[model samples]
Target: MTTVPQPLTLRAWRGRRVLALLCAVAFLDFVDASITNVALPHIMSDLGFSVQSLQWVPSAYLLTYGGFMLLGGRLADLLGRRDVLLAGTVLLGLSSLAGGLATNTGLFVAARLVQGLGAALMLPAALSTLTTSFTTSKDRHSALGVWAAVAGLASAVGILLGGVLTEGLGWRWVMFVNPIACVLVIPAVLALLPRDLPAARTARFDLLGSVVVTGGTLLLVYALIKAPDQGWGATRTWLELAGAAVLLGSFVLIERSARDPILPLNIFRVPGLAAANLTGLIGFAGMLSMFYFLTLYMQTVLGYSAIAAGAAYLPLTVGVGIGAGIGAKLLTKVGSRAVICTGALVAAAGLFLLSQVPVDGGYLGHILPGLLLVAFGVGPVFVGVTSAANAGVGPSRAGLAAAILNSSQQIGGALGLAIFSAVGAARTHHLLATGGSASIATTSGLGYALGAGAAVTVAAALVALATVNTREGESPMNKPERVLIVGRSPSVLVDAVDILRADGYTANATNQFDRVLDDYDVTDLDVLVFGGMVPADIKEQLRAKVDALNPQVTFVQGLGGIAGLIAAQVRAATSQETQDGVSYDEEKREVRLTLDTPATVTVEAWWGTSFTPPEPKSASMRVFDGQLDAGSHAVPLPEEVPAVASFVAVTVDSATQVFTVGAMPTAVTQLAPASANDNRLPEVGQVTT
Candidate 1:
């Protein structure tokens, strides 16, 4: 027999510890990406680099990070996730150290490239670990919330920290800080994570496909990065774009024929996968453009220092945290489609507000409110998109799913920055040529660019509304049945909850009955189950309180073990039958009747109907029992009876009753008595004479 694994409870110490570690790793990735932005000027001056060459410091990282992500994800699946994660962490730390100590531009750029590679390997592995470790939907949702919160806030935090570190300890410290932090993180990752399962030796590595895809992605990203500097219509830009297209097209052809493709083409067939990725792409594009334009506006137009400008983003970070929390809760209540659409619209509204900022605008009047709105709006979108992308994916493909999402964000950010920057620069140049001041021209350009970003965000919202599935991860067998299980042992509680959930019920188990009573509204529950270990008095008190609140709620008692409890709950839930003088034998395919005197009986079978209320119409069958001397009678059902028939109802004299077999319900009504000769099969859909 196969056994289901129990999910970790959010309240447990181990669960909290794992979530903290995962969030910390995610935080490091974002912080490292943005921290260097503030230190760019210092690095250029210290390394004696030209302005044009200095751009490579950030660009090199983006290239390697975006290019290698899919391959890294494939490695995680072919090898072990733990192995890939540890290797990446160590590499990230060493690269940070090398970057800090570099004496020349060449070495600095090389270190940045290595850092990007390390991040590519680390991110997807870490996400896969989190998704697999948190088995229950509730815990996974909470874990992803923390992950999303860290992702949303870390960029802002990085800017602030970079400014403080660069000013106090010099630019080198900005590079050195990540390695120092990794000293603490490396040991925790090793100690906290479980041992990896053996690698899948049978899985073939698709080296050719990997090379083709990586080259294609790198060329595409390079084109986008250089498009603003080089005229978009320039020959070099067009050639590179055309080359990227050819390479990507070849990758598709190669994957279709590869024995084991790095990215299986079939993964896209998963419901909502493509839609979610598209939403992420467009959404991230708008968000990244907003950050880039706003940062420039604060420093160049408003004359704010790096530290002051970074500090201004604190409100946005807090708003994102709030939105993540709300979105996580709403995922269970309303599903991903509604939450994502709502979030995208909110973000668009925020961007529209920011587009109206003037050169002389204060932080309070123009920046803060707009930042808050954008942060909150994007927060829910991140959560919804992440959930939609990963839903229903198997463990083997978990890393691939994470990698795709990360790549979407990275590529979207790069592309959005390129496109919006060009638009803003062109407008700025036009105004400058017409004799406008630098400040007015820059402000006007940025406003127009932001308006374009807002339009893109609105488009993302429409895409989400139209394509994201409403009932993600839901199974037909699992209706939304809310159940509460009270127990004394944690092990037993976890087991019972898993079993009930597997059977399609929404189950919550708690060892602390008192705490549960205080925390949850038990009256809203459909079923209440008491484990054998639960104290009788405590169970009675809780049950009495719940019954008073909702008298219709079913209560199951006297269950001894996890299996027993699950069985009892299922039986109680399906046992809604009202029988008088008739009974149906499911296995024997027969109906029996008991009578006190000579009386006519009518039997009917209702097929293909739901047991739940608001039942639909079903095909019915009727049989007549001629007036007969009393005691017991057996009526064998015809073999032609539909296999989908769910209930058999018998009417005796003037009485009627309803009963259900499996998921179908049956109802019987009083009928006139008929002679035994009337036992012939009635025409389909015709009333018996």
Candidate 2:
């Protein structure tokens, strides 16, 4: 009886406490950002701040939060997410406590700045934690769904919570709440979350590049926030922006020569990563500012009390929950583009509607409808872009990707708010000079600003439409992953085609490595399976060409069990069931090679009991090519390496060949020669061995 091959099995994280701890961090991020917005007036009054300085209250927090976020993300990746997360949690708690007890404006602003830093550290670490913890697609989708829902709800609900706390207990409770939550959550995080994993980056962290990038980001955010008040045409504004640009440009140069860069520029090449980050930058620029304007409209124009104004967002909060829940589930089904486009357009429509709220606007007719629409649309867009940014990313770079997305969003939000706030102020002044009422001028300014937001959101939709690929991800249950099988043996290829087709994949087979591109289009292909019989040089050449055609397609080194074993490896690559770099199968005495880049890999296996001193009882070495980019490849042991090898090590691009390995074992079947005078195909023995 023939046995079916077993694929790599992915185990989902079952630690609910770990998930909760991570979610708390996410919850804290949104709460900290949004809660302060509502309490700004109270803070200004209590801290004895002047009108111009009042803006600094929130700016202090936002400037640091947006600026340091990228550094925080890289820190999580370098130091380990668990450890970084704990550090950020502690910092945030302490900063919040300091803010709560601050006696003066300067002290409070200092506390807020540190609080922003803490938040910057926590957000990416928390997101990377959730992503790395969940190994399976379904589980990750569910977890991210829950995380997004909580964050979405927190954005609108923070305003309400701030209003309640500020009104009932005083504005100081807003600052106190963070520390209290952190104190309660710290024990759980320590008990549930795993410790920091050791890092592979041998060289020290890229300090020069990090410092330059952080300074650049901080300057850029500060300039954007200052641009409106200073006037867009101001010389100082231009100089600050230019300086920031220069610093950021220099950072790229520094990274190119750094032993290990904090941000590897190559990471942007990952499909959907750049598109998603750009989309977030544009989409969120409009979305976050809407919150600011709406709150201003309620308190400054409509004469509503803090609690009443806060209560009005209840519908928006509910809508966000519903939309995010549905969006997370629909992600792999409709793909990122469709979801992002749909959400952006819906949000645009909602923004346009909001732009029409008149001086006499009421809650239901003027505000609630628009708020609900924006909430629903914003929810899906947030979830979609987040997923797209992270799609197909390995565990090593998860934090970096998350941080990039957050940085884009933060920069966009800050820039958007500054621009809109300035435009509104300009319009309000224009109207007042033209003899309009204070209420009418204020309403007119807000309307025009919102209209501008609508236009920006439409642009975001266009970007998503142009950039995001709908066909290249792991979802769409209706269409199974497409795979192409390449090997020397006709029977093996035929068997692979039949077996994979039966296994519900769209599978194809070819015996020619040289003719792969001429015969097949690999752009939409997911996994490429190669038989051991294909020469190492030919495999490497084929991969280099295939990468140019479609770098996303994973190369899998396969072994015995025909279609069954090959199919399992394919499943593992697409689903991220196994580790990123390499895997080992003891029964088959083979190693699975996974690489993010093309490089020579020397695979060695050693066998020994306790009786050896300078040498192992048995050892085998196989040198694999100029480059092979793939999910996994078999490091099949020839007759030279016995099956009892105790350890296996893979070194990339090493000059040492060490020991020579033996030839292929005898085959069960062999291919026929090209002519009667010719010998059997060079790889026929290896094919069926």
Candidate 3:
């Protein structure tokens, strides 16, 4: 007999604290990645390094961090996540100690590479641990939510914490602090993580795949780094770029044929994964560059203290947390596609706002708007992307999906920073050659950098718009009962199924859209409401399909947006026949008139209260009323029309007639006979804004 797997017991499952520990570990990993930024000045001064060499500090770290991400992700799967986590933590501590106590530039750069490797390992392993621990869909989603929140906020918090540590205790502490954090968390992690063994799968390591991908990543990063120093056309730059192309091409080919792929080609077929990954790449590319440029601006140009700069970024961090929380709450209701696309577009808008920041711009006007917009844009994106990537993933492969997503962010950020820095530096050089002031050139360069970032974000928007395929704002099961009526409020139609289910109409109400199509035998679907539907091609197609399948089905065009129809009513009430109502402002010498008709009409102004109507009026209004004037004769209304200070409302009434005038003050078109009956006007209801 096969032994049944033991189910989780309540007391033995310390999953909650294990999750918390992983989050903290991920936070520490990112902290070391960016912490040196705030301490760059002190480092440069202590080492007596040139600006050129100083730049390498960031570049070297970014290069290795991005280059090794895929490899690290693969390692997480091959080795047990628990073992990788412990090893990574030890590597982090040792690297921190070495980096903090470095005496020479060579020693320092070597230590940074070590730190990047440690971070690369810790990040994927931490993510794998969190993802693998959750078994059920609901639990997995919840776990991802917390995981994404921590991941999103880590960079911002890293800088802030780095700033405080660097300021209070000196630059060495920035590097030293993580080891302390790691030591504090490791024991708790050891206790809380489950002791379950990893499955002994026969998957082999993809060394060829790793080498090609890593080589490509390194070459791409090398091209970026070199482009800033060497001209873009430089032989070294072209060689590196060409090498990157070849390596990446090879990587793709190998992955397809590999028995055990490092990067699975099949995950791209998942509905949400491809879209989410695409958007995440674009977002990280644009956003990470902004941080690099902004950091330079704040410290080098604005001369902000390290601590002060960190404090200034707090608003953005807080906004991101709040935005993510709000997005998480709304995802179940709004659906994934709408939220992700919207988030990408919103992020592009934020980048646009940020690009407008001038050399002398104020923080309140230029920076704050951009910061808030970026925060709001990024928040939903984090949650939506995380959810989408892992939406249908099995427990065994969830870690792989998470790794791909994480790698996208890391690689995108690295590439974005490198490209934008080159742009900024190039622009600065161009301005300086023209004899511009150093400060002016610096700011102008920042503008170009940010502009490039905005452009990449726009590309991201296009990706999101094109590739994100999930339906927006749909309930899971739309129809649950048979013989249902649809000629009611859309919400009411939705509610009917729920009510009927409670009343035992059928097998319970459903919100799944596809189930509605399948179970009802489209021919048997008794009713449909047209007016409640949005004027969308998808809805139209669905309607056509149902109509074609079941021609006998009844359809009811339940009126929707009645208030808009009434607003159309108010617009139609302003046309005049012969004598047009006009208001004049003597001080401004302006006169305007409104006319009544559904047809487009134009109004002519002659700087007088009364003037002959032009054959073709420049402006016109619409009126949905009982009737329009019978002929071309102007009929004045007794009621005082709602008039703007310089405009007057006009009304005409008859059984039914419409008249148009031309530029020569002659009638353009007129109905020969009026309709026999008038449409009665309904009583006005309260208007909603």
Candidate 4:
């Protein structure tokens, strides 16, 4: 098996700029999510909002961000990725401008809500672009490593920039910053990245399915967010949670009947996928809560100013960047399970250590060490899980898998923060009720949250240990090469796809040969097969087009009707290097073959100046080994062959019948096996000694 992928050379992929643009967008997302928190108080005061209502500023963004995320990913796949990405970017930029300039709570909150929807659209498109842009694992690993580091750094920088903007340029600048960056990004995108291919002509949006899924996810996120304050046992909370479950169940039913489901029910079947998503959820739950409680402790108990608290995280940010670098390096060397478990243990230790913070603890003595540990563990977990989550899903659904994993992390963060905060608050309340000092109670509560987060990280490590395999954890060859089958009937093509996929090829099919270029990408294409039912003229046109487009693409003429025969033709086209059972008869104008192995082999006969085409006449076929299992078999050519045409069958060079080494035959002829007395042997071992 091919293990290592070719290096992602920028000159070839033109990916350096693409990676930069995607990273910029991701950074904006992380920064915007964190930046608003620092300025929440300012907005609350200015808009005359109460404490409960103030939560909406952040919740509004999270609500739609998580709610519309899956839909956005499906849209990226169905619609052109560039189109969705641009739409999202424009919406986000406009929303940011609106939020920055708003004078009242309603307008600001509305802007924030739109921002979430925009993010829902933007993030998946960006991630899918990143996923599809680099086809090789080494390239992907290198790219994701960079992206992982950027994400870690961006979250930290967001807090730092949040404080700077809130203190220096006023809180509105925090909202304004996105638009300024957008101004630079819009043109950069147009100039840097090529426009995405046009959307498939037959693609459907699954509107009803989208509505059900969006509603389910939104309700789910809302319930999780409010459960802490609403009380988990509250009738309202239970009703909301139950409603979400019902809608999700409804989504499953809807998908079974939908012509094209937005999120395919079958994607969950990908190996290691469930565990990867679970790891993401558990990992984010711990790390995000750690950030939250640490910030709270700094601002409330340690009596640090907002800026000072933000600046204090600098070392943690550096540590995470360093850790991410380390993780990327280790992922290939020691494998994902080892790295994930090790990182988690180190992080858990840090969180546990931080849990012992004294009421009067300082940053250096108490906080920095824990932050370093969390950073160390978090980097590898995110990097490893990101790869693990996406393994073997194929390019068609890359966006969906990316969206799902991201959604899990977002929900995990929200849920973890809620659970930990609620527990800590209750503990603090209980301590104060018992007459504990205010500082001690606050410190103790923060410590409790951190400790819980540590426990969660440990759980994430366990999942990785259980589910991750050496290949997924160690190398970048996560997805197989893709095949595109063009035929006359959709059903026939779909059946072919199933067979090819079952046998380990990442395959897709389309009935319209004219739309092959639009329906699927040729970048990662391994084989392009024209079905027997497709028009000769259409095949000629498309084959010529593909030939000019990607000369390395193996072209096979599907000279057979059945799905199994078509799949066999594809198999032969891809595995010719080891095959040696075919030859062509010039006078007979036919293909001849012998089968020693009981396997289906597809063969191509070329006739021209050379045995390979660019020849004048050629024939392709699938030969079933069962029909000729007892002995050598001969395959006759099509009757329509011109009497004058020559033929050449091809296979790799292989040794013919064996003969005695001591004597060379002056003339060779086929004959019955030699009589027992005629067998050659070395006389007395031909001993020299």
Candidate 5:
């Protein structure tokens, strides 16, 4: 007989140890990106690199890292996460050593590229390991929260460390530091992480898909990186972009026929996956451009030394930690939708504030506020978006899911940099043509670019509001079928019911437990929650009555106020089987409905506080007036529904079921209502099984 592995608890020593090791790996990856920014001047002076060729030092790493991420993730699935992680760590150590010892530009650039490859491999593997090891929603959320904090903190810390190291030890030590960190990490990973399961020898690799996808991504990223310098309208830029398009199109065709594709297109069918990735892309684009432009502004306009500029980011770092901590806690109470949307809006506001900085702006008044706002706003976004992207993904494709999320950031940063660079350059040239001073022209141009970045962040917020689910505490898979809250206090009962209902539960509460026993049917309820204020004999009697009605009904005692009730609900929900096969599409404003058999399904849309389906006579909107055969069908939704609709009811014959629709991707502008006589056909789309 086989035994299932138990979910890791908060106090588990092994879980915490593994999480620490994973976070170290994540920190190293992000730190490496920013550390080189401060050391670039020293590297150029020491290696005799021309200003024109110096960009390759950073571009080489970014190109290879982004290009190979999809391939690396697929490899982790084919081989094993632990094996890939160990191999990647060794490669990173060797590359760091090579970079430190390099005396020539070519060697150093090559080492950087190799380091990026190692990072691509290790990052996905580490994320997949974390996802697989945690198993439970609570632990996974907490672990990913720490990982998000590390990612944000490392970037700021990297700049500070780079400035200190370059000024004191030299640039070589900057390259050598990673190898030393890896040496310490390797031992802990081996001891703390579980060994990978044996792989099947007969498994085939998708070499064709891998080649096309990697080559395509590399060309695309390279084009985006060079577009600002080459000019967007330049022939070389257009040609490279066209070539990338061709290669990527070929990859899609190959994936359709391949035995094992590098990236299965079906993953897009996951609820909120596509929207989450788009949100990540837009958010990162704004964030990365902000960082890039600000660094230049500090050095050129503000006349700040590298060390001073690095130190100035201290407030931003602290703000990120504070935001991430609050986000993690809020995720359990409110949900990812609320936290992510709020964060993106705040970040946009911060970017807009930064855009208002004048040519002679002061650091404390103009720069600090913007930096703090952006940092705090983006902190929660990273955590919430990451959780949403990876939720419900199986272990087999966990690495692929993580890779997709990371790739969005890379691609978004590249695109944002390219577009904003062009925008700024165009604006500056126009100002110069109109007889403005160079200083005024430059500052004005940067302000316009920052405004564009703010717009992009706003777009991200809209995506989150539309597509992300409003889940609290546990995931949908971990929610109970039904919950009954029994209590004496009306306030406590109301609060508990509200919390549970917000979490997508079929929850009901009553102050009169004995009255409920006589009037309501208790057979269908999965959980019986008793308040702490309830008498012991009364609770025992209620439990006996519930047990007599349904032996499967779980009795949870010692409930305090709202928090305790939520906690009990989570525990009960985690042990129960959950509803599946329902997904929402934000772009088309539709629900991909799946049925077990051919039936004439009536999907009634509702906008109200309660998640429960109203009586057949009470439904206001009959959104999808069609029959869906077995499989999946994209049913059109009500266009003029409120910004946040509570739920939709699917009625087949006499059976009616309610599904949450509040998390569907929302539009910035409210859509106009369709006319009654309008015969516009619903645009059909595929949903992968």
Candidate 6:
């Protein structure tokens, strides 16, 4: 009997095997998608198709893949993920077989379209599987890092592999190869994937949403693709653009109203996730656009053969793979923000370098460094971006979040290519007007396109930098450990953290121990410092969840009450004072009071205010020096005779004392920082004796 693998202790071999299966699945997903690009020319030659008709072979697949991803994600959520995945695999296999055996161009195009639908289904299901399987943040980031690396490498690998297969065997091998690959995944998936449960909760399908978003994306892609051929201002172009706008607008409205939307609008409210998706979209768009033109420039303009052109992309593959692997390690070091921002900026630099290439520039001097830089930049960026985007999203919305991120990449790719090409066309026109040669015109246009790509990535970097957080608060430092403070005083929790930290424990500060046991993911935690509030039920539930996630989480319980616990382990560190003898640490920790004796000092509150007496027509005196004066002076200083019993009515600069008083304190009042008269005070609210 097969059951979906829940959180449990599993054999190490089983986990490794499952991970290997997923890696293979990811490789197939990427390789299968890109391989067709290599076979396009061959397919056209055999079927007697024109360039115009042949373009659809790739475009159709990309369009369908982008347009239906949201629907595919919803399907995975509604249907059992494994069931959808297996179905997609079957369809993918069948579609590949049909595409390979196509006798006519139309049949082949139809097969490609079907293949895309299968891919649409497979991509989300595969991503969701990883999310569902890897519950911990660390594991998820690792999984995505591997996924990003494979996706990056697969692009270069596809062209190389596709060319080899197409040339050595036949163009048909391009299509036939996928099904053969699919066969390997099927067995592993069947063996490793737990049985799918019939979905306990079913969502109503968003038919209107499906139509609008798909139609909008299709129209938008078409208009962009058409713009290079059709004039930018052409009536047909604007009409399609307008249609896209209306449809996309309608899609947003539909999503907002739908009881269970295919695309959840609420997910955007998550700051990290939203920023990640936006950055990914822009970065991917820039990358895809760069590739589209670079490929054309290499083959069409520079006269590189198909095999050589494919091989030339090696630098990018190496760069991205290295960058992504580095990102995984750096995630723990600098956090996601620094790594992602750095990657985006580096990628932009690469694009800028590429933009500097002249018309007749060679690959070594002109392109190699740029390509390598971009490759290095992109890999890490994707890893960090994806990790940040999916961070802390609950399990239920994992598929939806992943779908959004991937969709942004796809949509951005299409849009980037379209917009970049359009910009290139305008640049080419400007070059022609300036009496430049055709070669110069083309190169100029290409440079402008690359420039635009660089700009997009730079913008992405800025956005990520502004929005992403590097704090790893989900760890023990953010959540307090439950240490039982034995004494009656409530200072036990504070003391326990100090003691735990001193005692070599990764303890977080938690005010309420009763809630910490339930909310925090303490599966891998060691030494849970127990307080007196620890109930057997709470302990049992925590132990169960911990054992399920990871059994090594240790539990350490403290024995005494609050004050008693504080005395046993560690004494609290005193607040450090500045050179002016003023302590800045107002961390709202345990309350303590100290009296000031005839000392002139400025006391500032959180916002900076002063305190003074409420009387007027009194003699002015510098109590610290015991110097009495009849008139007021701007350089007045106050010192308490004995101790100021005045309340913390106000605060001032560090130079100003809280109050000046006789042996017995008089009335105390708070004053604003700007108050000139010591006799005036602000309104009093609460009185604490």
Clash-forming residue pairs, model 5: 466-664, 466-665, 466-666, 467-665
- When 3 and 6 are scored with lDDT, the better candidate is 6
lDDT of 3 by residue, 21-47 (tens): 877887787656677888788889887
The TM-scores of all predictions, comma-separated, are 0.70, 0.71, 0.65, 0.74, 0.71, 0.68
lDDT values, one for every candidate:
0.73, 0.72, 0.59, 0.69, 0.73, 0.62
Sort all candidates by TM-score, best to worst: 4, 5, 2, 1, 6, 3
Show where candidate 5 strays beyond 4 Å.
1-6, 198-202, 433-435, 473-689
CA-only RMSD, every prediction: 14.1, 14.6, 22.4, 14.0, 14.8, 15.4
Residue-by-residue lDDT tens digits, candidate 4, 1-689: 11111113455645787788888988877767777766667888987778988878878888889888898888876676778888999999999999999989899999998999988888888877776666455666666767777787877888888888888889899889999998888897887666654222123578999999999999998998898789878999999999999999999999877756787776786768888888888878887777668877888888877688789889878878888888877766776667777877888888988888988899888888888888887777766777677666544566787789878888888888888988888889999999999999998988898889889988888888765553323432222377887766443454455455434566766765666787566866788887656777888888888888788888876643334445555655665355455555555544555666554432322111212322211222221112234336555544332333222223322211110112222111111111011001111111010
**Candidate 2's residue-wise lDDT over 1-689, tens digit each?**
11111111124244565666777788998878888777888888888988888888788888999899998988887787778888888999999999999989999999989999998998998898776666445556666767877888888888999999989999999999999999987787787766644221224778898899999999999999899889989999999999999999999898766656888876775667898889999999988889888888888899988888788889988998888888777875876688888888898889999999999899989998888889889888877887778775554567887889899999999999988888888999999999999999999899888988989998998888754543234532333356887777554464455345433366676776776787677888888887756778988988888888888888987542233334444554454322346656666655566665565554543322222322212212322323555445566655544543233444444222222122323231122111100111112112111
Q: Per model, state how many residue pairs clash.
A: 0, 6, 28, 0, 4, 30
Candidate 6 off by > 4 Å = 1-4, 7-11, 198-200, 430-435, 470-689
Point out the higher-scoring one by lDDT: 4 or 5.
5
Estimate, for each residue in 533-632, the C-alpha lDDT of model 6 and write its tens digit.
4466766765565567766544444322322222222211111121232222223211122324232222211111123423111111111112222222
Off by over 4 Å in 3: 1-15, 135-139, 466-689
- What ranges in model 2 sit over 4 Å off? 1-13, 198-200, 466-689
**Candidate scoring better on TM-score of 5 and 6:** 5
Q: Relative to the unseen true structure, what is the C-alpha lDDT of residue 370 in candidate 5, on a scale of 0 to 100? A: 88
Ranking by lDDT: 1, 5, 2, 4, 6, 3
lDDT of 1 by residue, 477-507 (tens): 3343577776654434544553454344666
Consecutive 10-residue window with the lowest summed lDDT within model 1:
669-678
Candidate 3 has its poorest 10 consecutive residues by lDDT at 670-679
Clashing pairs in 2: 555-630, 555-631, 557-632, 557-633, 557-634, 593-633
Worst lDDT 10-window in candidate 4 = 670-679
Q: What is the lDDT of residue 551 in candidate 3?
A: 88
Model 6 is weakest, by summed lDDT over 10 consecutive residues, at 669-678
